[model samples]
Target: MMSVAPSELESPETRLAPDTPWVCLVWNDPINLMSYVTYVFMQYFGYSREKAESLMWDVHTKGRAVVNTGGREQMERDATAMHEYGLWATVQKDD
Candidate 1:
């Protein structure tokens, strides 16, 4: 039997790495219309009409879409903005 000391388990691998990219995800909701979601993407992200439509469709069928990616603070801000726009949104670390 091998026994490990407690100190051996607390390695640098457990620390939170800096500059890790995060993502803002928009989830599908029953209240918001597809047109409104598309419009929000276009208006908020400045995406092209076709691009916004495509992302909106992705969210509709897939249940969620990665709308933005950056630092955790930026993702949080983006999720807040989506909330203000009446969309279901959340910030998460990118895998």
Candidate 2:
């Protein structure tokens, strides 16, 4: 690989900023039970029982809930983990 001179490298101050915040949304589905949803939130994100239950209620009654918020990569990971746990999930840039 060709080596670049120090001047050719992007300086920290000139580099692009870190990625914008993103969110993982868990959608309501008939397959998973409410208790299981709460458990998934608590287990995966280490959310408190009350917080998990509140999010679960939002998913149940509102059709979806923002389960996580962070950088795009982390939000994607959260969505994938939710999928692995058999929950419907998606990631999007937070408004």
Candidate 3:
């Protein structure tokens, strides 16, 4: 194994600033039920029933919702978890 220096790594020009925010977007898809989506939101995020339901509604009506936000790594984890739960999700840098 070889050790690589951080300075040798290439960061893309579009890379986010050090503290730039990221978000996990949950998209409405035909497969998952609305009740299941809301339950996932509550289970994964620890959101209250009302909050989870509200976000679920936004996803259903808007076709998507910003389910969570934080550092890039956190958003990535959240998106992955959503996928594991059979939900459509993506992580993106907040604009």
Candidate 4:
């Protein structure tokens, strides 16, 4: 059998493309209230009340929600902001 090179074993992101859009995700936590999460989304992201509530519900029931999507740097910034608001957050390339 042929052997593969180290360079060939790239992550999905690297193999797909470098400019793939990234997303900031907020995870559910026991401490933060659902209303507070909804409020944060409305205030920080300027989402409509209904939209904010929907995302908050997603976090509550689904365990996580995509709070923002854009470039990697922007997604990182969004994740940091969520952290500042005391929400669990992380960034990853969009599938």
lDDT of 1 at 36: 94
User: TM-scores for all candidates?
Assistant: 0.80, 0.80, 0.81, 0.81
Q: Report the Cα lDDT for residue 59, model 2.
A: 100
Candidate 1 residue lDDT tens string, 1-95: 79899789667776555567899999998899999999999999999999999999999999999999998898998999999999999999988
**Angstrom error at residue 58, model 3:** 0.6
RMSD of 2: 6.6
RMSD values, in order shown: 8.2, 6.6, 7.8, 8.5
Predict model 2's lDDT versus the native. Answer: 0.93
lDDT of candidate 1 at residue 38, scale 0 to 100: 94
TM-score of 1: 0.80
Evaluate residue 38 in candidate 4 and report its C-alpha lDDT on the 0 to 100 scale.
Answer: 98
Off by more than 4 A, model 1: 1-18
- State which candidate, 3 or 4, has the greater lDDT: 4
Error of 3 at 22 (Å): 0.3
* Residue 74 lDDT in candidate 3: 92
User: For model 1, what is the error of residue 68's alpha carbon versus the real structure, in angstroms, after optimal superposition?
Assistant: 0.5
Per residue, candidate 3 scores C-alpha lDDT tens digits across 29-73 of 988998999999999999999999999999999999999989999
Off by over 4 Å in 2: 1-19
Lowest lDDT sum, 10 consecutive residues, model 4, at 10-19
